[model samples]
Structure formats: C-alpha cells, structure tokens
Target chain A: MNLLPTEEQQQIVDMVRGFLAASAPLERLRPDKFGQIGNPDAALWPKMAELGILGLGVPEEGGGLGLSAVEEALTYIEFGRALVSVGVLGATLGAHLAARTMPDIAAAIMAGTSAVGLATPRGAVAGDDGIFSGEFHLIEANEADFIVLLTSDAIALFRREEFTGQSERLSMDSHMRLMRAALESGKPLSWSSVKDGIDHARANLLIAAYATGVAEAALAGAVDYAKVREQFGKPIGSFQAIKHKCADMAIAAEVASCQVSFASVILSKNSDESRFHALASRIVAVDAALKNGATGIQVHGAIGFTAEVEAHLFVKRAHLIDFIGGDQRVQKGQFIGADAVI
Target chain B: MNLDYTAEDEIFRAEAREWLDANIPREVRPPDGPGMREFDLGWQRKQFEGGWAGVSWPVEYGGRGLSLTHQLIWYEEYAKAGGPNAELLFVGCNHAAPTIMARGTEKQKSYHLPKILSGEVAWCQGFSEPNNGSDLGGLKCRAEIVGDELVVNGSKIWTSSAHLADWQELLVRTDPAAPKHKGISWLICDMQTPGIELRPILIMTAPGHHHFNQVFYTDVRIPLSNVVGEVNDGWNVAMSTLGFERGTAGMLENIRYGAVVERLVDMARQRLGASALENDDIGQRLAQLRAEVTAVRAMTYRIASRAAIAPPGSEASLARAFFSQLQQRIRRIALDIIGPDSIELPEDDPWIRPYLRTYSNTIAAGTSEIQRNIIGERVLGLPR
Candidate 1:
C-alpha cells in the first residue's frame, strides 16, 4: 500500500541527486561550441560509472549492485532533473541487460572499462544476429567502447570501432552527441532475437520507465521556477493560469511515476500482470512527457523555447523518446493485441 | 505498487460477482439501446435491493464497509457483468452520502443516510451558479437567516439530476456583507419546498437525456437544522465534498471506460474485415486510440495505487483531467472508425448517442479547461 519510496531508496535518491548536482549540472551540458557533436562532457561518463549507477539494476553476482528497476528509476528521475544527457538512461538500461546475459561484458561496463549507447529501430541499423550497420545517432558512440543496437527483432552489442561511422553535430540539445556509423556485416559480440511476446514487453517497460523519469525531472524544475519567478507584483505561481498548468504537469508526473513503479514491481515479482502494466506505463509515460514538456515550455514563456534555458533540453529529449521503440502509433497496435489476449 | 488483490479481497470479489449474477435480472438490464435516465434509475434501485449499493460506504451506513480494493473489484465486476451505468444516483452515492457521513449531525445521518442507501431518495449537486462555475468562491446564491428557518433566494445552474432528485445539497450565501468565500452555508434543501422550481435544461449533447437542470429558489424556506455543518462555515463542508469527489472512484470509472474502449476496438476489428481494419487510415487511428486508452488505464491505475496507500488529493486531479481528455479522444476515434455510418444511424442506434453523449463528459464534471488550470496551479505550482 505504500507509494512513497522506502527509506533506503530515499537515501539512494539523495545520493544520486547530489552526484548530478555537482558533476553534471545543466549549465555544463549546454551546446556552446558551434557545429560541435553532443555536449563534450565525455569525462562525466566515467564519474557515473564510479558512482556505480551504470550497474544499478545489474545483479550483484554479475559484478554490480543489484537494485530493482524501481530504485534504478529513481536514479534516472534525478538524472532528468540534472539535465545531464540521455546517455545516463541508455547506459544504465543497456548495462543492466548486458549484465544479465553477458556477465563478462557487464563487469567491464560496471567497472567503467566499457561504455554503451542505445540504438533503436528508428535510429540505426537493426537486424538478426545483432548484425546492425548504419548511422547511429546520439551514439555517445564516440565515448562508448560498445553500442547496444536495438531493432524491432533483436538486441545486440557491437564494438564501437568495428564499423566506420561519421558524426553529424546538431544544434539542438548540446548535451547529446549524434553519430552515423556505416558497417558491412559488423561483428556482433552477442545477439538474441527479442521473443515475439516476451522481449518487446520488457523493452517497452524499460523505455516507459526511462521516459517517466525524464518527465518527472522536467516537471520538478519547472515548478521550482514558477514558485520563485515573479511577474507584476507576485510570484508567477500565484497566478491561477500558471498554477493550473503546474498542477496538470504535477498530476501527469505523478500518474506516470505511479505507473512506472507499478510496472517495476510487477516485473520484479514475475507476475502475469507485467504485460498489462508495461503497456499501460509506456502509454501513460509518453503522454505525460509530451504534454508536460509542452506545458513546461509554455510556463517558461519565451525563455523556455530558447536554447539558453535547460527547459528546451527536456523538450528535445521528449521528442526523441516519443518516437523511440516505435511511436505511439506502433505502440497502440501492441496494446490492442495485448487487450485481445486478456 | 503491486495491484494484485489479497486473498480476502479476491474472495469478496467472487462473492460480489455471484450475488450480482443471481440478483440482477436479465430483463432489468439496460437494453442494448441508447442511454436512458429512467432505465438507469430502475437498475440503480435493483442494485440497492440486492445489497450491492454503496460498496465504499461504512457498514453502519448500509454499505459493505469493504476496503477500497474491494470496492474497486466490485466496480470491475459490475462493469463486466454489463450492469447499467449508475448515472442516476451518481451524485447521491459518490458525493452527498460521503459528505453527510463526514459532517452530518446524528439526526441528519439517521434520516438521510438510510434513504440514500436504500435508493428511496435521489440527490443532486448545487454548487455551480450562472456566474460562478470555475470561480466557485464568487457564488452569489443567497440564504438569509429568518427566525427558525433559512430563506434561500438564488439560482444554481448545471445541477445534474435536479429534476428527478428528492434533495439538493445546496450552497448559499448566509452573510451577504462577508467576504465572497466566507459566510457561505451548506444546506439540504427539500426539492418539494415552497418557492422551489426546477427547470430541466437540455444540455446540447443528447436530445432527450436531461442529465442537467437549472434550479431556482425564490425565498424557499428550509429548516435551520438542515445545515450539514456549522452555520457560516459551508465552505469547509463543500471543500470536503470536493475532496472525495476527486479520488479513486473517479479513477475506477476511467479504468472501466478504458476497458470499454478496448472492447470497442476489439469489436471494430472482428466485425470489420482485416483489410478494412488494416489498410485504411482507421488502423492508424485505432492504434492511436489504443495508445490513448492504454495511457488512461495506466494513469488510472497509478492513481488507484496511490489512493490504495493514502487519500488521493491534488494528484487525482491529473488523472481526472487525463481520463477526460482520453475519453474525448476515444469518442472521436470511435466516430471516425464508425465513419458516416455513425451519424447515419437512427436515433435509437445503440452506439451513436452514447458516442455523442461523451461530448458532455468534459463539460459536465468540470470543464477540461478548468482541469488544466488546476493542474498548472496546484500541481505545477504555477501562477494562477
């Protein structure tokens, strides 16, 4: 019946929040250098690895701290608030999966000896046997020793240098770097076809959890701004118009958080309910991130739309997630299919 | 975070389902037809007689006194059983009864609680006025204290179920000179009282379904003892009512509707051939609808999970608004899939009017715009 995080979980949250506050403040991630690939804070990746966050969800036997998805999700929530980069989410989940299936590689990832990036169907090459070769955008690819390439059919790991790639720097979201890799039969360290029913369900749940964290952070930052920023004679938060928007954002964030948490628990328990919870969480989390991000921009007025504020970072990240692992349209078909089975 | 029912709760659910299956007659079920108020009322009474009413109310108040989980299970079963939408007694069961249980004097509880539970007396809400819908504090409905009776002279619009309701949980200004929010009183007004007139207002959606009414009071005299709480402190009472009005039950309703949307999508797929379902743009639209429905289901469960652990407050508002939007989206998608055939059906067509009736959902409880404002201010800590 408890919805609040456990005392231990709260301690972990405080630690993560503090770590991000000091090491990867939003200001550091701003895209200042024109034509530069993502934010050049490649140094921070090792710091996170040192914090053991990359292995947050991996089993202790697999050379990592074995926390449940719920605890890992809280870590990502703080990550969202810090506006560090999308790499945090990708690296953590990828490390978790890799550790579960490939222990040796997982140990390397946890020890900061290896870094991984996530590439979905929309972004890079995807196919059987982890044989993926294409321009993988936002690869953190330059820094990662390996990349976790996700396709509609399978998830596989690839050596970063095994494929020739070009990095195209973009103006939006300086905190993230984009790369395009070209490969002719790139070597696959490991590849397993995502089962028709099982893997997609798990992937969807993980993606939803990540999106929920992002939206929550965006919401908290916007609310903090509204409460302090003043217009006319009072704090902007005192105005009903602004208050209502914040209220809606808060509501969305709360619902999304609840759904993600529920899904995590279901997964941990290995309950039959996981499929329903996973689908529901993805649907709700994506909607919340989209709507909450838009509302965040609106509340920030002109500044939120500009590159100077970190609000746009949240917005850009939301757009990226919106299409990842199949957009709302594709996700809907899966939901209907699940419903029929139920 | 876990949504699995406890063993006891699961047993209770089975008992409830069996009881409802045996007691609720097949003939009494709302026909496969358009929404009808009279039919809804008959079904509500049937639920009352079967002891399936007020699953959330305490046993002392003639309810099952079950935990919220049990209540949710009851609702889920009721919806699955194809039970009638209990729209007729919604205000009584959802709002007024809870308010009375919380704040009513012993006498008020003794006289009203049993009748409300027994389906002997229906109730309607009297909160919104012509000028003060969202701005509830600015309500000008006046009630002057006179001798032993309170003389009420004001009007309330959008009062759902007033025409047929036996009682109105009315809010009126007791002290005109006091601040707008202060000096208001919450009174239980007998609908048959002198100088009371209920004008049935036809909300634009369904032509014959009179779900809303305009209630006018011209010096209607009610006993001073009818006040639910302390005099000049009705605002507190109203706030308490509004609090319960926004909780797990609302979320349950949304989840139920989400299930209905799931069924609709399924029906569309089965009846329409695969090519019709997949080839046309309807497939994309249905897919989006599925996503929206899933979102609504997830958000509702999220609220339910929170409320399962604690009393839901501002958080419920988010789920409420999200569900409302999702409902509208589902309705639109349903119409789009049904295409022109939806409108071309006769008025008696089972789905058309219900589809049209959903237009009132956002406007009825609280406008979607109001919901957005609440989300921004209360949840987001934004400016008013």
Candidate 2:
C-alpha cells in the first residue's frame, strides 16, 4: 500500500527539476510584447532526447528507454511546469503506438529526427479502404513530419504530404499555432485496431499529466510573486487574502499531482480501474490547473491580466490541455458510466 | 506506487472483516445518547477482546503493535463493515493513550494504556476554551502548583463526551508570567474531581446527540504526577497529541466517508430510479465528487506512506483540512440528491443530520481557515 515514490523516482524529479530550472526558467515562459511566447534559447528537442525523455515510454527493443507510464508522467509534469510545447509529448505518444508496426518511425521519433502532430478526434473519419478523410484539428501540425489521426474505432497514421489543405490559427497559449487540415484523401498505411477504451484512457492520462504541470507552474508563479511583492508595509503574502489564495492553489496542485500520479500508476499496471482513474485524473487536473491559473492571475493583481506575465501563460496552456482531452463535463460523464472505484 | 496489500495484510484484512461481520449489529446504532454510547463501548470492548484494538500502538502498551499498513487495513475493513462510531471511546483510545505512551511516565503508561484499550474508561480533550477556541495559546484556564498537587480553575467548551468521560487530557495555563504558548501544561484530569461542572450543549444537527459539554473547573486539584510532560512544554505535547489525532483519525474518517458516499449513491439511485444519473448536471457532479473522494483516498495513502519516510509536521493538517472539507462537500451533494427530504418534518432522514453536522467538520479540531493559515505559513513557507 506504499504510494510514496521510491528514492529513484524522487531523483528523477529532482534531475528534471534541476535541468528545467536552469535551461527553461519561468522568465522564458513570459509572453512578449507582440503576444508571442518568449521560450528559452535552447534546442529542446535533441536536448530532451539526450535526457531520454523522448524515448521514455517506448520499449528498449524499439530503441527507446522502456520506462513505465509513471516515469513518463513525472517528466510530463516537468514539461507542464516549464511550459514546453506539446509537440514532444504528441511525438512520444505517436511513437509508442507505432512501435510494434512501424519500428522505423518509432526509432526516428526517439532519435528526434521526426515530429508527430496529434489531431483532434472530432472531424476525422476512418474508411475501410485504408483512407481517412476529414478536416483535422492538429497540434504542432506545421512542424510535424507525421500526423496521428484518432477516431472512436481506430487509430491511423498519415504523413504531412498526404494532406491537401492546411490553415494555421493561433491558440490561447503563446507557443501554440493550432492548425486545421482539410484532408483530400489520407492513406492509413497501418491502422492499429485500438479500442476506444484504451485511447480515451491514454488521452485523459496524458492530458491530466500536462494539466498538473500547468497547475504546479501557476502555483509556483503565485507563491514566488507573493513572497517578494509588497503592498502597504509588508509582503502581500502576509495578508490572509493572498495567503489563503496561495494555500488553495497549493492544495489544488497537490491534489492534482496525486490524482495524476495515481492514474499513471494504474495505467502502468494495466489495472481494471485504469479507465476510471484516467478520466477522474483528467477532470481533477483540468479543474486544478484552470483554478490555479485564475488564482495565480488574481494573486499577481493587474500584471497577471496582461499577456506579459507568466500567470496568463499557465492559464492559457491549461485551457489548451483541457480542451484537447474532452472537457470536464464529457470526462465526468464517462467516468460515471465507467463506475470508477478505488 | 503499488497499492496492493501484502499477503499478510490481506489476511489481516479478511480476519478483521470476519470479526466485524460477526459482531456489528444488523441495525444502525442510535445516532447519539446513552444507547449510542453503549453501542460504541460495546463495540470497543468487542474489538479489544478480539485483539483488534490499538493496532499501531507499541507492543509494550497492550496493543497489536502492528504496522501502519495493518492499521489502515483495519480502518478499511471496519468502515466496510459499518462499525459503530468511535465517539464514545475516541479520546482515550486514539488521542490520550497515544500521547501518554509517547511522553508519560512509565506509571502513567501502565495506568492509562490498558484501561483505555479495554474500554474501562472514556476520556475527553480539554484544549479549546470558550474565549480561546482558535487562539488556543491565549487560553486563560489556569492551574497553580500547590505543593505536590495542582489547583485548577478554568472553563472549557466544546469538550465532547466530557459528561460521560472518566478522565480528560487537559491543558491549562501554569505560568501566567511566561509567553502565551510557553505557560501551558498538559495533565490528566480525573473527571470525578470535586468543583467540576458539566453542562451539555444541545445541538441542532441531530436529536439526542448531546455529546458536547461546557465543563467548568472551579478548584479541581490534581496530583503533580498527572502532568504528561514537563510543566511548560505542554504546547509541544498538545501539538503532538493533535498530530496523532489527525493522522489516525483523519485516515479513518476518509475510509468512513468512502462508505458513506457509497450509501449516498445507493440512496440516490433508489430515490431517483433509473433516471437518477440521466441528468447531466447531477451525473457530472456525482462523478466529480467520486473522483475527489478517490483522490483524497490516494492523498491519505500518500501521506501515510510519507509519514514513515519523513518526520511528522504540519503535513497531516493538509490532509485533515482537505478531508474535512471533502466530507462537507460529499454530504452537501448527498442532501442535494435527497432533495426536499432534507427539510421535511421529523428531519429523521439520515442524510439531513449528517449534512447539517458537516459544519463541525470544518470548525472542530482546527477551523478550515486556521488550517489554510498553517498550510500557507508552515507548509508553503508563505508569510505569517
């Protein structure tokens, strides 16, 4: 019944935290004057691969780390805190799904030579003729070497060249450029007969992990600001108003972190309760992230409302993550239907 | 991250389940009053006789002295079997004895621990006073040392079960000239002492549930040996007592809340029929609450697992605050699901009493407000 992370897990967290603190400080997440993101000056892809993050969930036989989902969740939390772009995780997921059938693509993904974009499952339709046609909403579409199309019944992979029309739209997150693809005819070279159950679980778990990261980041922003920002005679944090808000943010982040970690552990074990936990984790993480983001902005006062502050950045990224895996209402409904138990 | 019970834990759980199944009454125990008290004591005695009491207490103290994992398993199985409320014996069995065991003299341990575990005596805590509820350090309850005895003069309020208790784990100001937090002393007060008065406070949450008492001590005298710790170090002693209370009691409360939630869901289904969860809003809220409960369970487990690795501190307060508020939310949802029955005549609806009483969950022990302050100042390192 021990739920405490082993010494190794704590080391992993500290290692990632140390790297992120140095390489991608909170200052880098601040939005620029043009509302563009001012991310760190680092080539993150190869650096992340060098850290074994890109190959975290892939099996060793597939030329990857073969780490458990729990380990992947730990790294994803750091990704959320650093506000790293979603392309890396999308690529990891794509590689994990393609590992058995498309080892070459998996290896390419692990080596950081290929990028994968994940399309929203709403518009895409899979046909029996090994073709998928729909206007797909994609994350990191422009930079993706391959795009993974998700549907209720199956998962299919499509190369960037297969799509005919693509239009990019800006997202709430400064770093994101959301794209919509008008697919003429996409060849599904190899479709995995993945059940909607597993996809729903996977999607929610991944999104929850990212959302927890965002919540942690927002809380950190508020706490850091509260300590140094003075109003009247004392630090604003001395005021119960700010103190209580920060406390609530801490609670939210803590609960979300626990929920996400619990779900990831369940997923790693392939437990019967995995689906329930995943959906529950997503609901909790989404709410926590959004709430923490809003509270972070409030704690920062006027500066937080401006795009220049990191508060809004966490808030915006939280919304993006929440939107990706169905909203809370949808996830809650699924959770109830699943009759999740502890 | 493995939550699976070890084989030994599983066996212990099964044995606990069997014992509770065979002993727990089929009917729900009376909510409060003499019948409820008897039920609680009887259950405690049964558990003691069955060698199931004081699970995590040291072996030298007449307890099973098992692992914390075993204690958690006992709580889970006990809650699942719908064990009677621990109110009647709570202070003695859970709080006082543990504090005594940790800091009391060998004589005190030998005197109190066995009687407590055997349910031969009931105890109440005398920490919160009328004027010093949240500001406990400012309590005016005074005790003056007179030779080998201590003369006490004070009033304590919200002392639950004090009227029925045989003894009390008391805190009093012993040195008025010292700082507020440093002047206090922790003592074991015999409830039968002369010059003591008990006035039960009538509560609105449930009928006949008058467990709370306003106890006044005009000039109660106690032997100096009754002091649990050093004269002026009672603040730390009391805090340690609260720590133990929060850890075991909080974990047990989470498990109990889980069972209560299951019943609430069952009632919801029975009342609303097949379409109960059809309403999207209700469904979403129920599911959200369910998730929150599970998260709390995990949080509790995490805290338990961490307690072994880390030194105890204000971390337990985090779980205490979170679970207390979660209990409130769960009952509110339950009442909402119960609808008009919540306000009906007789007010005997099971959900109504618990829903209203949920107010105490946040207020007692430490207010949710105070808990937030602790988390902010102590846990998160925010400014005081």
**Residues A12-89, model 1: lDDT tens digits:** 989988887787776775557323345545566788788888888777887778787667666766665565566555
**TM-score (all chains, Cα) for each model:** 0.89, 0.94
Docking model 2 quality class: medium
- C-alpha lDDT (0 to 100) for residue A37 of candidate 1: 48
Where's the lowest-lDDT run of ten residues in candidate 2 chain B?
A: B273-282
| lDDT by residue (tens digit), candidate 2, A1-342 | 777677888788888888878877767655553337422422677777788778887778877888777887888888888887777666777777778788988888777778777676444364566566767678777777887665533566777777766787777675776777766667854555434335446656877888899998899889999999999989999999999899888888888888887888888887777777877788888899999989999999999888677888888878777656345665665666555373
When summed lDDT is taken over every stretch of 10 residues in candidate 2 chain A, the lowest stretch is A33-42
**Model 1, docking class:** acceptable
lDDT of 2: 0.79
Best DockQ among the predictions, by candidate number:
2
Which numbered prediction scores highest in lDDT against the true structure? 2
By summed lDDT, the worst window of 10 consecutive residues in model 1 chain A runs over A33-42
lDDT of 2 by residue, B1-384 (tens): 767777888889889999888987666777777677677777778788889888888888779878788888888888777776767787887789878877899999998899899777788899999999999999999999999999999899999888778899999999999989999999999999998999989776655468689999998999999999899889988887676666656777787777776676666667765354744566678777888887887787777787667635786776788788888888888767767666673634667777788889889888989989998999889988
